[model samples]
Target: MSKVTLAIGGMSCASCALSIEAEVKKIDGVLESSVNYATETAYFEISDDKLLDVIKSKVQSLGFSTSDELHTPTEKTSGENYLVKFYISIALSLLLFSLAMWPLMGWPNREVNWFIQLVLCLPIWAWIGLKFQKSLVRFFLTGKSNMNTLIGLGTTAAFVYSAIITVFNDASVSFGLTQKVYFEAVGFIISFVYLGNYFEERAKRKTKEALNSLFKLSSKKALVEIDSKFVEVDIDEVQKGSVLRVKPGEKFPVDGKILRGSSLIDESMITGEPVPLLKSSDDLVYSGTINGDSVIEYIATKVGKDTFLSQIIAFVEQAQGSRPKIQQFADRISSIFTPVVIAISVLTFICWFFLGPEPFWGNAISNMIAVLVIACPCALGLATPTAVVVATGRASLKGILIGGGEIIERSEKIDTIIFDKTGTITEGRPSVVEALFNNDEETTLMDIASIEQFSEHPLSNAIVKYSQDRKIPLSEPDSFEIVKGKGIIASIDEREYVIGNKLLLEESSIEFQQNLTPNEIGSYVFVACNGVHCATLVVGDKIKSTSKSVIDELKFLGIETWMITGDNEIVAEYVAKELGIEHFVANALPLEKSSYVESLQAKGKNVAMIGDGVNDAPALAKANVSMAMGTGADVAMNASDVTLVKGDLSKAIDFLKLSHGTMKIIKQNLFLSMVYNSLLIPIAAGVLVIFDGPMMPPVLASIAMGLSSISVVSNSLRIKTII
Candidate 1:
């Protein structure tokens, strides 16, 4: 049998994990399996008979995906099944509560029949705790530490010892445990935490809905042309070269090329572009894109798991399991915590047996169970994950996606943030910042917009967008010639049209006025129509509205901001100084940017690099942390740890604060959980039961559990203010 760990996505609660575990157990040749809602991964032992493919296909059939292939792990959606388990546990608990208290309330109990208490609580204890028993066995076999070991030790000792004492000891002996079983407490330990796990899983599921939403876009069926007839078929059944008929307003069912028709396609799902793309024969189409008008017959090239939906789902799932940058501390804390609590619980039994008045096995077992029940790592396990879920959820609302926990963790420590010029700090798209015309003709705007549309360039694109806003339609031109690094030459009827920068105009020996404003930053292009200067199109990129705010926020938060751009020194300096960023590297190439970020790291500075160009990919991957704007090239986005959805800078601020808040909460939760466990469990075992009155185990467990939960939840809620 091969044991492989798969990071499972779409788990939101402990019960959801449990459901997945139950499903996994149904597979033939599967020996054991477990799913953790907090960690969002499924652990399973599969025999040689069950292939990995079979295991994975079965998992996918259940509306979830596994990340067995990703080089790194990622967070995933925890959905609704987990909530069902929570309700089940709660319902069972309520039933037990009513049953156990009936005797106390004098509701036809043999005045406290021990057997009645045992019967009411046994189902909950056994049903809810079977998983814990499995984990305990694993722990004993591996000698590896886990929270379940302590629980198994405490609850088992409490039940067996109490049963032994009750069977042998006659009543009125005054031995603490022999007198009363507290079997209900054993059941309560299993049920109470299941309640916590339920709520936590629900919260986790709700927070991770981003990936779920992303995965929902894939089309399930496609209309395939079969025997000269159009018929709908499941997407998975459609193979390559199958001509699929896609109707207007339908989402494309598979990745393919336009074979027999044309339409406007909304590629925004993948590219995040707001505009729709016109499709003709041979125009590539991606699966899940919306078709605007005209029926399109496209040949399918990929489907099912090979499609982008499956890739994205797999990416999200795998990313959740990759090593976290800041989880070392948590590992250390959890490691030290388990053993220390175990030792303390053991010592509690010994101390009460030797030094205290109620030193008998009865109270000794009660104290041990108290120690295990009270010292649970619910808060510890929850600390980091809760904060991450909350922070990541808030980020998604603002169109930011954080893949790794360490990105946020290390991003919080970043002292310097380097921004690329084009598409990072600037809008990247050139527009007519200023337009000038000597003539007062009413048709001047139309003339320029129409002419510029004949040529494709940054400057021409700017004029086109501008003219479209003014309701101008471009006309086709005859004899169009594009001069490299210069102007465009087109013939309108018989006259010649020359449009380009000053250098291009000079090369053509065409004179044009240089009445350009000095303060404006952009490339200057002068257009001459029919041997007369018509208009000048000034193309330049504008700084994003949020860039300055991001810089100022970083500075205010005590981090330094810097810039590196391939633009001219003056333009780079202008943007840098305007944003209040003091450091900059002007005229940097792709390699230069990577080297600069590398140098910073070598100097012991943790640097975060933000960029959007394909050239920025290397630098982004090189940085201590990386952020990609939504409009960034695909490679850059893939290389980056964080992606900004709106191609804006404001989210940079949100990420930093979110991580810091989460880490703070983790510390608070750990401290709170530890402090409560240290103080209360001993007291519950009747440490001072003889002096300050014997404290009830149930009430003490409730208070300790409450304190741990309150601090954990409160700390987690603190991150809600980050956005």
Candidate 2:
């Protein structure tokens, strides 16, 4: 399948996004599609790559704009200024309102005052309200409605009804018509809705501040070394394998490996670690990281869009554009909201006209306009996407890359968390703290190191490093077979040898002397030669300092924690106890780890798994939510839902806390919108008028509608501060 993301424009509410998504999905080859109103982007997948232009054209036909350059900030049209129009509309609205109320103020010439109100209200309705008028026209032509439709209908009704009363003033009185004209209501509704949209737009921009900050981190120029001479060039001009020079306090222009010199590098932008790390020759450096007070030369390994910083930006953009499950529920309601509201307005007009008090024609028209103005779908549409965008952006800043809103939803409900011991709860780097031998020590060390040199396991690297540090001579094994989750079997110099955990040795029927086994809290590797018990090597990895605190926090939150590892019972038990994890499973194979997660899930537990190796992939995929340490294997990160870039165990707590906080903000936004619409829609429809309560006027209804949407957007922005 092929995918495309288009930056969408002119979306007034969630219904606009839903309408575009619905139309885009009707195209052949389009498999899936989502349009995020908060992020103003559309994401879609297709069976064929050629469907790209077709989808864009389809969106244009629906009266919305699309851009293929999804990451670039959208610029406002050159001549479009809603704020300028708002100033004009509000000035005219205030003057018109005064003129319409002149007779009530005991002023003379009510007929002349009505004509003056008409001239003031015309410009506000026809000129300032042109955008909504166009949307209303599109609704008739295309049969799709949005927030603008309601605004257009409400203002037009009041404008036309008042214009008739003013033109036929004497005839209307003889026909028992009310002498009042609602030109002020027309002007105020347009002015207030414009003001609300202005604030909403400003608040929406704040939600993307994190993303904009990331864009600012990119280096624009690089000093490249050409023929032994440094030359300044555009960052995009620097190619992979080109040597580059970074001066003191300069940002690395591209991802590269240091070829000469050393420096203290600040990688806080990429890893969220505040401290600068010392780097020497042969250390890999990423683009957008600040170099400390030293000159360094490096060979660029990644450039342009392939840089580490670029990938993080892409990840953040994708996550922000994704819709969470709760947002889907909100979208469903918003899709039909405008049409249902129009139906209710019609019903309200018919009821009020037949049964309302004296001046029934006036009451019917006023209540109908009020209903149309007050039922805002914009608030309901914005409730969830805005929160998701802010939450995901904040998470990216903390070095946590959440996949999308779906992951955030899943994380909020996680009750049980299972962690892979190595590279997760403990420092994956192991070394030979102590080695015991039952036979010839030199020969055993040589054989084990030689066989382990062919293995890529963390334990194998530890043993290899130990032998190299001691200057111990080593030889390659002639033939070898790796036992998954256990050890390795090899033929060294025509001698059969086994090196692995106790289970591998015992399964091979090679019994070792129990008294020779070390009682230390570390992994034990038993060695057998020629079917005879030979030696035991103890490898130890330190528990991460943050592991205990994270575990404690999880327990305090009433979440169950468990540790699972392939390491022997001794090491697993020790790490589990040290970290205060009450439950653990040791001697688990890769599949066995997945089975344990499955068992928990079968018991109705919402489980989360954190791991950092290829062996941990199955279990990571099986859990309700999975976190991968960025310092671990690529396979593990690919299988997980959240990636902690610095591999800090504390980030796990950050993820859970962020999830809970984000969901809380979303719920608050939803409740605010739902309650505003439910309470006011009835009042606008004159439901309270039957009990002698005051009816909601169109001017007040427009104000309430605007505030409802502004409140939702403003509430979503609070997530950046709260989370």
Candidate 3:
């Protein structure tokens, strides 16, 4: 199957997205389709290449357009032209409204004055409201309906009825008609609607600013070595394997490996680590990370879209476009809203016409226009998705990657958080803090290093690194073999050597002469040579400084924290105490960790599992929400709901805070929308007309509807300012 992502245009709400998705799914050979209203894009997979055109045509039939070209994150929309139209429409609308109120000020020529109002209203409706008119025409042609259809029907009713009265001049006196024309209503309807749309577009642009900021991190040009001479060239022109010269404080143009000089690189933006990392020959340097004081030459490993930064941008875009379950309900409501609104408007007109009003036709038409104008479902459709888009974009800027908006809801309900010990609470790497020997210290260290050098385990590498750092010589180990779950065994200088955990030495019958007491917290690695007890190496994995603060904050938030690890009880207890965690499980395997999370969930707690993302995959999957370190294995990241880019435990707190803030904003938006609709729909239907109260005019109803939608969008943008 082949996948294609298209940037869709002219989508007004969640219902529009749903309609396009349903139509696209009907296409032959379409495997799957996901349409996102927030990002205004559709991602689809198809079994056949020939189905793309058919799919695009189907989307077009639903009053939408699609493009394959990927736009830059900062690319401006067609808002300028809309703004110009709104300015002119508002100016003309105010002028017409003033003239309509002229008779109230005792102005003369009231008979000929209606004609001038009609002339002024004509340009406002025909010229300014032409976009809605065209959209309405398209609906009739394609049998598809949207927000534009609502605006078109509402505005047309007022304009058409007023035009009829303007043409039949004598009817004003003969039938005792209410000489009030709805020209002002038509003017304000289009003008207010246009202003609301302009403001909405501006807010939507700000939501995407986070993605644009990511794009700005990349350097446009790179200094590449060509024929032994350095030449400045476009980033794309520098192919893989090309040597790039990066100066101090300059951003690396592509993912590369150092070829010559070493430097301290600041990858804080990408990784969220504030400290610059030391780099040397053969170390990987990513695109967009700045080189420090030393100049360096590096070989480009990946360029263009395949680079790490490009992948992050793509991931962020895909995430911002994702729909949470709340959006599904919003779409369902909006889908059936239009037809019901039309039915209500017709019923409202019938009730008003046959009931008590003297100027029955005029009153009935005015009330009908009011119902249509006030019943726009734009706010309902925008309530959830607009908030989600802004929240996701803001999270991405903070080096937090949320896979879907659904995660935000999950994070809110998390009452208990389970963290994997190694690499999660403590640094994954263990180092030798001290060594205890029963024989020659140098010989025992050399023998242990020789045996460990043949193995690639974390502890083994730490041992070899310690030996090398201490300037000790090592001999090669022969016939190396791994003792599953224990450690490694090898023949060094024709002597049998064993190096691993406590279990390895115990099983090998190497009796300890005396119990070794570690002065500090660490994992103990035992070394045995020739079946005789040799030495005990104390290897300690340093606890992250932020882990304690994160746990403390979680406690303050009324959340329980627990640590799960495969380490011995002593090490686990020590680390847990140091971090001030009250609960922990020692010697838990990966499956056991998952089971522990499940048991907590079974007890009616919402559990959030935090892990390095590899060994903790099972538990992560079983939790209510999973957070993975970006520096961890890809499998872990794939299984996680949220990824903390810098691998900082503190960010997990920020994630929960952001989730709570976003949900709060979404609830407020939904509340405003429901309240607006419930209160106004009855007023627009002329329910108060029986009390001799003023009948709602279409112009005032249109203004209210416009304000309601703009209010919802403005509230969503507030998520960006959330701490």
Candidate 4:
């Protein structure tokens, strides 16, 4: 199946995303679909690409706009303009509120002020309140209710009731209405709701800014050599095999190999390292990295979406669109919240009308309007997603690439962390340390290096470099064959030789008079000729400086740390002791490492596996949360959920801390919303009126509702401050 990402518009809340997702799934041949309100994008998978147009039409039918165009369009100006409208509405609201309160304050001329308040509220509702009206009408047509439906119904009820009192003064007075007016409440409700949206839009924009920062690092234009002459062209015009000439201090425009010259390139954007790397002939340079002091010419290998920079951008975009498990729960609650609130408002109206004291009509209408105004579900809808967006963006800035919301949840719960030895705890660069031979060490080394020269394994390269540095003459091998994870077999000097691990030798039924093993803390590779042991060589790798500190930090947090390695028991124990790790599994195969992780999880531990080699991919996929070193193999990175761009083990602590902090903020937001609704709903329903308590005014209800949403957003933004 093929997929497409469309830029969606007109999404106001999480419920809006749900509405779009529900419609998109109905299209024939659509395998799956996800709509994210935070990013305002819709991703779809289709079995047949021919039905794309029909799917787009289905999305638009739900009253949302979409574009398949390249390069994201700039945001609309509605947020800024809405703020201006709110200020004007608020000014008029304050004036109308003061005039309507004149009678309660024992001031004169309050009896004739209803007409003036009504006239002032007209502009507020007709102009600033039109959005709520339009949303309410759309919902009425589709039988769907949202926050807008509640606000529109509450404010419109107040304005219409107040207008009736103003027009039929004599009849209202006869019915003991006393010309009571709530025009001021109508003005305040609309103003506060709009103000809430304006603030929300501002916070959402801050999250978008974090994502856009990545796109800004790329250069738009490039200078290339055409027929030995330099020419400037757009980055898109430079194709594969094109020779691109980059000057000092300019960014590389495409992934390429150096053809001439050398320079120190800054790869901080891509690798999260501020240090400059030296580049020369045959070295690779990626797009968006800055060339530091010398001009260089390179031939482009990958262009457009195939470049490394584009992949990072695409990765971040896809991650931003994913919903965490907590966010899914929030969406489900919001889907049911609006309708339940509408039902409560109706019940509140019935209860107040039958039980209210003098001026029953005015009290019943006011209290019922208060109930509707106070119960907006916007805060509930925004609780999880806003926190996820801010937390993910903050993590990106710190060089931790989290794949989705579920990673945040999973990372927080990790109680045990398992680390692979090679390329993880150790530097993964092994060098021959000692050579033990029964007859001649030189003959064995030269013969083994010759056959291993054709292999790209790490140990193979180390053997070849060791032989070359010793000035040992090598002979060609015939009929070379490699057994993965074991050894290589070839014919050297009319004799069959095997070079590999002890397991490979045992499988070959090799026998030697004395099997000498190295006592040092390093790996051993045995060489055999004609099914007999010839020599044994030892290789050692340096441990990373941060491994011990990382282990200490994890232990300090009450988490257990374990080391799993394919190395011998002695080497594994030596490294584990140095890092202060208490648990380890030595001489483990790739499948055995994954089984160990599963066994820990079966014992109720939340396990996280960190590795940077192809052998670690299965274990990485088996853990609750997996991290891949930025400098590691591509297969390992693809199998992991989190990528440490600098390969710094210290970032593992940051990942856990970030998850804890983000989950804390989400819980706080959800609590604030739930508490606000719980306390205000009863008062708005007039339950307090029994004890002679003040009934909740529609104006105060609107203020409380808006503040609840603003507070949730403000709390989410606090995640950016986490270190």
Candidate 5:
């Protein structure tokens, strides 16, 4: 075994990398291969005399252009060049087609003279067949090939053999003999196949562009400072220890430290948190994050793929490139399908040639062509990929990012829906709702928020948020100190302040609020100042407005809903009852969530677990369908098959519905393709002549393909426009 490394381009996400790896590994003599997506390369170990060109062809066939080609040979790709070539090809093919049909358009039989037909079909096949012919030439030249080799040899053999016979003999048709013409089959196949793949390739390229565009958001140029004067230079031209100046409101182009000035930075682009963070001198800033408030300068520490934005892109690319289990089935089946069908066509021709005594050459040629045209996998090829791409695209717009086709299929039928409680179905933050002052007009509520802000706790954030929302003015408390075991203590305007639970108040020897409602399902904090009770802040966490609607919609769709949480049984029961969820496993541990999901699965139900980010990671990995929300933890995001980027629970069910619709479309397409084939294959094999009449295989093949392709495309188009 030896090592082989090939550069793999246009893989923007992990799934893309995985798909390429999967395709290459399918070939014989390929022992192992490792593809590094960030570097855009694949390394392989192979046996002697293995077919590298076939592997490259396989990659190209799966829609990702390989990087090993030294010249720009794939016509043109990605930009305006591609558009020009595509339009030109279409126009040339269409013109040639029209010219060939001109004489027949005015006829009663709509028929053409055989000589005229041969002349007309000449350019149509040659002009458009150049690509196929080129590949065919390369295959014979190198002895390395795959389907292209098969297509080239089979079609070229049929066409050239027929052309020679026509030129040599006046009688072009011979029964059980060496004379027959199949120029039409070899001529038209490549032209139409190219037409079928153009738009499909376009969509795939755009999906890659979306990732590239994200990476492109980083500034490619930087302002370098030398001798106190700023000089413009490309980011790659600058490196670590290079001083740079970043103007206020201008995006910092590189990951660096602040050399001069202080400013706030908006990191929402990477973190999804919109709050502008305060940064001072010597603080590090990430590339592409917005600088705010003041003019700031920094040193360029990192650039290019080393930048944070590039790292994020790399992770996404790697994940997308990892192939899913189901796609392997489709690819293996589809790749073999065409070859098998073509073989049957050859066999059908051979049988007819030997068995029929007074055989007709046209009839035998038609049967072979029938097999080629009828066996086309335009429908089978489109069946899974079309719906998968569409469903995944549609799901993305609705906040759910499905990983692959298998996930899409699983999402189509959801039986038990499990939701994580905090952050997912309820407001995770607590707030002060009621503040009471007894026998004092000292602004007790205001003083409590002032002290509470000094502490770092979820309960404190709740109170702070509430007080700020109420427009309460808080003073910086003097002599601020946190009582380790109890709470925080501070002196506001020379007056001592304390905020915490009952223990802190007791330690302060102050009266405190008691009998706090347990069913309140929220953390609480108290306030005291100058050794006397100032106010009691009732902290409460509210349910998200969207949660109710999400649940209601799911119920309306007849989906069974459940809520599982580590929160107390009382709190869990209260929230579940409010949302009208009947099945709940409250106070369950993180592992228990998966256990509960497994229990549902034990009953033969397809379970979808909806969870808060990190806490639900395990359960998400366990469920048949895992949907993680925007607010979820990074672990949850990675674990779940479907990630709701918007954190909209309503889209959870909507995405399910979208998958269901996509599956329905897939089923419909398969049914139509099979039904059409069942009728056409038999008829093209001359099965229906005894009953009805005879039909041309070429015309029938074109019709079968046109119908299948147009319907698949039309149905898949629904995904693009879907919400």
Candidate 6:
């Protein structure tokens, strides 16, 4: 399957987005499609790449436009600016309203006064009519309705009715009807709705601030070494394997490994950690990170869209466009909202015409226009997506890459969190703390290092580094084999060697005396050679300082914490105790770890797994929510729901806090929108008119409808401050 993102244009509300999505999904070879009204973008997966153009054409046929590029702040929209239109509409509407109120001020309201009001309302009505005409045209052509449909219907009805009253002033006496024209109502309705759209659009732009900041962090220029001399060039001109020079306090233009010089690099842009890290030869530096206090020459390994910063931006964009489960409810309601509201408006006009007081025609038309103007589908559509976009973007700024809105919803319900011991709770860097041998120490160490050099395990690397540090010469083993969850078996100089934990030694039938006791609490490896015990090596890794505090905070939040590791029971117990964790599993292989997570889920627990190694991938994918350390293996990160850059465990806490805050805001927005429509639609329909209660004027109804959408967007923006 192939995926494509298109910048959608001419989307006025959520219903327009639904129409585009429905039309695009009907195309052959289109697998799945989603359109985010708040972001004004559509994401799709298709069976064939050729269907992309077909999908775009389908969207355009629905009275909208599509661009191949993803939507950005600077991108031009096909629609007119509502803010500028609102300014013009309001200025004219105020004059029309004053003319209608001339009688209330004890002034003679002449026929020319009515003509003057009509002239003032003309420009305002024409501008907003053109703005909503596409929605009306789409409804006629495709049998779909949107928020703009209601606005267009209500405003046009008022304008037409008032135009007839203005032209025939004496006919009202014979028909026993009120002679008041609603030119002012038409102008106010269009003006207020435009003002509401202006505020909503402005708030939506603020939600993307975090993503825009990331885009701005990328360096535009690079100094490359050509002919052994440096020449500044555009960042795009530099290719992979090109050597580049970065001066003090300049941002690195690409992801590369340092070949010469050293410096303290400030990587806070990617890692969200303020402390600059000391980087030397062979250390990898990423794009968008600032160089600190020294000159460094590095060979670019990854450039352009392949850079780390670009990938993060892409992830953020995809996540912000995703629809969460909570949004599905709102989407369903919005799909039929316009049609249902129009039916109610028609019903309102019939009831008020027959049952209302004197001036029945006037009351019926005014109430029907109010009903159509006040029912807002925009608020319902903006509720969840606006919150999701803001929260996901804010989370990315803190180096927490949430997979999508689904992850955020799941994160809020996590009751049990499982952490991998290595590189998660503790620092993954292991060192040889102590070593003892029964036979020749040098020869035994040489034999162990020779076999371990071929292994990619952290323990193996530590042992190899220890031997090299001690100046012990090594030889390649004749044969080598790795025992899963155990150690290694190798042959050197016609003698077989067994090197692993105690389980591997006993399984190999190697006799070894248990005479050594280490003062340090660390992982132990027992080695035997030719059926004789040779050496006992101890590898120690320190616990991270934040692990204990993070665990304590989780406990305070009424969450259970569990530790799982592949190390021996002794090492696991020590690390668990240090972190104040009571539940733990030791000597667990990759499959065993996954099984433990499944068991927790089977017991009705919402478990979140955090890990940072290849061995943790299975368990990470099995948990309710999986978080991967940024410094860990690629496989583990890919399988995870959230990536904590710089491998900071504290970011897991940040993710939970952000999820809770975002979900809360979404619920608030939904409740406010539902309640606004529920309470006001009846008032607009003349529910209280029989009891002699005041009727909702079309002007007031338009204001209420506009404010409903603006309030929801404004409420969604509050998540940034709370999180």
lDDT of 2 by residue, 117-236 (tens): 888888888899887787788787878876677667667766776787789877666655544466776676677567656544543443344356566668989999888899999988
All candidates: TM-score: 0.64, 0.54, 0.56, 0.57, 0.60, 0.55
- Per-residue alpha-carbon lDDT of candidate 6 for residues 1-723, written as tens digits (9 for 90 to 100): 988888787777667777788888888888898998767788899999888878877887787888976435443232247767877888888787688767667665567888898888877767655656566666767888755665566666667667767777677555444444667766766765675565456444433443555566679899999998999999989999999999998999999999998777876444322235668899999997889767999999999999876766565555446553343445456447767877898898899788777677767766776666556444654666667778878888888877655567778889999998878887777778889888788888998998999986667888999999999998999999987557898899998988888889888787768675456777688888888887788888767888989999999999999998887688788778878896998878665777898899899999999988656766776677889999976656755778898888998999999999988888898899888988898998889866788777545654565578689878988888855
- Candidate 5, which segments miss by more than 4 Å at Cα? 1-343, 355-363, 388-397, 433-442, 454-458, 514-519, 538-541, 552-558, 566-570, 585-592, 688-700, 715-723
Better of 1 and 3 by TM-score: 1
For 7-44, candidate 5 gives per-residue lDDT tens digits of 56644334446556766888888888666543356767
lDDT score, residue 565, model 5? 78
Q: What is the lDDT of residue 708 in candidate 4?
A: 82
**Residue 615 local lDDT, model 2:** 56
RMSD of each: 9.2, 13.2, 11.9, 12.5, 9.7, 12.8
Between candidates 1 and 4, name the one with more favorable TM-score: 1
- lDDT tens readout by residue for model 3, 1-723: 899888888876566787788888888799899997756779999998888999988887766788986545644555565678778887877777687767767884666667887888888889878877766776667556666666676677667766766788587446544344667667766765665566455444543553565677779999999999999999879899999999998999999999998877876444322235668899999897888778999999999999877766665565456574454344455435667778898898799789846677766766676676566544654676678778877888998887655578678888999988877887766688778888798988898898888765556778899999999998887779987557888887788888777888888877865745457776678777888777888877778889989999999999999998777788889888888897998877555777898799889999998987334655766677889887775556655778899898888998999999998998898889878877898898878867878777544664676688789989999998885
Residue 526, model 4: Cα distance from true site in angstroms? 36
Return whichever of 1 and 4 wins on lDDT: 4
* Alpha carbon lDDT of each predicted model: 0.66, 0.77, 0.75, 0.75, 0.62, 0.76
lDDT of 1 by residue, 580-687 (tens): 897998877565777898788788898998988655655776677888898766556666778888897888887777777766766676677667666776675556
Candidate 6 deviant stretches above 4 angstroms: 46-53, 69-81, 91-95, 170-180, 227-233, 324-334, 344-723
Q: Score candidate 2 by lDDT.
A: 0.77
What's the true lDDT of residue 678 in model 4?
77
Candidate closest to the true structure, highest TM-score: 1
Spell out the clash pairs found in candidate 4. none
